[model samples]
Target: MRSLPLATAALTAAAVFVPSLPAYAAPAVQITKVYYDSPGKDLRSNTSLNGEYVTIYNATTRAIDLEGWTVKDKTGYTYTIEGVILGAKKKLTIRSGQGSDGTSTVYWGRRAYVWNNDEDVAYVRNARGKLIDSCGYDSTRYDYKNC
Candidate 1:
């Protein structure tokens, strides 16, 4: 009984002395959304394919240059980001089909689809190959996933 009381007192003292940890900070760049399944059938049309996309958002307060960044899927389908600077607190939508690059959108220019309908993972990496964020979906019920 004496040993149990001593241990309890020690634990209580330690708990009182320990400082609370800070909350976790959000990622600078995050894969916020993934439009995995395009509308209608998987006909692989430009419009249909354009519907499939991944939205990468910058969560930081400063603009992030994604010149050399890369966006990839589970099966290694990668889209190398070139000549782009994502604005602070803004979203960059990377579509699967071909399109002209814009301030908020870019094209992967792939003839075939990248995201798997049933299940897939989207990964975003920095210019130096550091992974910034990723989002995944395993269900076909929902066509999109808000990451």
Candidate 2:
């Protein structure tokens, strides 16, 4: 009977403290900004398309390997991240048009724009397709949203 009471106390203590331990409870990365509408005319040029981009920020203190991760819009237009390691507390801009990939920038290589000008949602997923973070905007008055 004494052993049973002691075991119950230990289990109760574990349950009470386990969830309060210091841990990373939020996503390491998030969509920080989105430039849905490019400046000037919507001429559909590569440079113009590149002007419209989404910027993601790493919120962790450690570098995160983003290979095979994905960023998708509401209509299923997705960009699979490849060979990019996000540094701690940094931002990466994913461009819509074709370009060389750099440490802080990547190109989606899409000929057409992906995000809707009226309203849309951007979902970031991990390599295993688990949702990490999401941001949405519904405004034609502004060309960008600080998500």
Candidate 3:
């Protein structure tokens, strides 16, 4: 009983002197995967080009409204995304060719290949042109083979 008040006061003083941790922001949308190389007999065909895609992921547990996002390749090919709601922990794949929008996939409607077989970089930006995420590739090296 004699030491209860002294212990409480000491703990309170230590807590007051200790610094609090900084607050961290939620994770933004990111390019989790990139399928730059299309595997088929005809690389230029609509079917083959449509197979090349990039996948964006929302890792958080809240819906994100991607109203005016843009995905651009290293060769200046830009795909503008319209009104789309990305659900929590969900992924959206944007193909290089034409197709109707689905629950987890969308189309870029490109006639030619947007990504190169040797090397390339894919960038994802928000409506304000701020980079959300990006992925790169290098086919020439043995260790860097994401092309």
TM-scores, each model vs. reference = 0.87, 0.80, 0.77
What are the runs in model 1 whose C-alpha is more than 4 Å off?
1-12, 19-23, 140-144
Residue 99 lDDT in candidate 3: 85
lDDT by residue for model 2 (47-141), tens: 99998899999999999999999999999999999999999999999999999999999999999998777889999999999999998998865
Model 1: how far is 23 from its true place, Å?
4.4
Clashes of each: 0, 0, 0
lDDT of 1 at 46: 95
Sorted on TM-score, highest at the top, how do the candidates line up? 1, 2, 3
Clashes of 1: 0
Q: Which scores higher on TM-score, 1 or 3?
A: 1
Q: Which residue pairs of candidate 1 clash?
A: none
Model 2: weakest 10-residue lDDT segment is 18-27
lDDT of 3: 0.84
lDDT of 3 by residue, 26-108 (tens): 44788876787788765588889987899898988998988899999898799998878999999999999888998799999
Best model per TM-score: 1
Better of 1 and 2 by TM-score: 1
Model 1: per-residue lDDT, tens digit, 1-147?
Answer: 799999999999998897889998879999999988889999989998899999999999999999999999999999999999989999999999999999999999988999988999999999999998999898756655788
